[model samples]
Target: MAKQSIAEIRKKEILSTFYEVAKVEGLENTSFAKIAQKLEIQPSLIVHYFKNRDELILALIQYNLDQYKQIFSIAHADDLSHQEHLNKVLDKLFSLDWNELYDDGVYYSCYTLIFRHPEIKGKFKDLHLELRSGLKTILEQCTKAGFLAIEDPATVAHQVYNLLDGTYYFVSMLDVKADQEKYLQQSKTLAKKLIGLH
Candidate 1:
């Protein structure tokens, strides 16, 4: 693989630090100075990569989408059968592993941007569409492999994703582990039912 450019590496570093800082400080409260200080670099370095706070925020939203795509990555694992891969994808989708991938605070903060920023809203819509498309591809493969008999993989994919998304949002509000697990399992069950699985 070709080496990453210096600018690419620097921007990634800045975005990662910005995410961490935003998680702790809240996205509205985070600033370039805070991200730079966390990275132990000059604030101008961040500004050089991101022209303004809005630019940084937009980039961060994209970063959030990228992080979420990690959930479906197991679908490409070479060793697993299609059935096993789909199970793993479903399990990961409803589990707390997603919470570990990205901060809830930061995610919801960016989500709220859909109300005020058309660009952010468009990016978020793309993110959801891409996720649904990925899942649909996986379901289509399972159908072709005889592991599933989905007639409309695209519709099933959308339904499963909506189940996962809504479940996570509700689960985030509950403080008890047992309660969270109960809801997650319910969501997973519903998702399986949607996909014609038992």
Candidate 2:
């Protein structure tokens, strides 16, 4: 295989370093210098990869969303009925068995950053809309398969997507065991009812 390009290697190193720093020190406290220190590289190296902190954050947001698409795509892929597939997706999302080590923290961090930084907030919102669009397509297919109600798939998809986003927001904020399970189960019930699967 040909050697990886310098740009590819630097991008990979930067993202990996960013995640490590964000995971340890809350994302709110992460900085380019911290990531540079983590990688034992000069801060200028990080700056070279990302023009500024805002650009770095945008890259991180894309990375986070791509990860979600990867997981959700595989988890929900099957030739089952719409309701059956929806049920499986919900179970995969709301299961408490692995809540302690869930990957939702990265998203929470990204959202929190956007909430604080209004200038880049639009980009974050765009990414969210993109996610909702994907979900809408899947839900529309389910409706055609007689899995969901005969309503606007886009509208219904937004409802389901918002509920999930809100639920995970709360989940990432609380103590993993405190009321996470209770809230997630309640979310599952509500999502089922909203999607008319119950």
Q: Could you give candidate 1's per-residue lDDT for residues 77-172 as a string of tens digits? A: 899998888889888888988767889999899989889999989988998999899889999999999889999999999998888888989999
Q: How big is the positional error of residue 158 in model 1, measured in Å on the Cα after superposition?
A: 0.8
lDDT of 1 at 55: 85
Clashes of each: 0, 0
In candidate 2, residue 88 scores what lDDT?
69
In candidate 1, which residue pairs clash?
none
Tens digits of per-residue lDDT for model 2, 1-23:
99999898889889878877887
Models 1 onward score TM values of: 0.95, 0.81
Give stretches of model 2 more than 4 Å off.
1-4, 75-78, 96-109, 112-119, 176-178
Cand. 2 TM to true fold? 0.81
The C-alpha local distance difference test score for the whole of candidate 1 amounts to 0.90
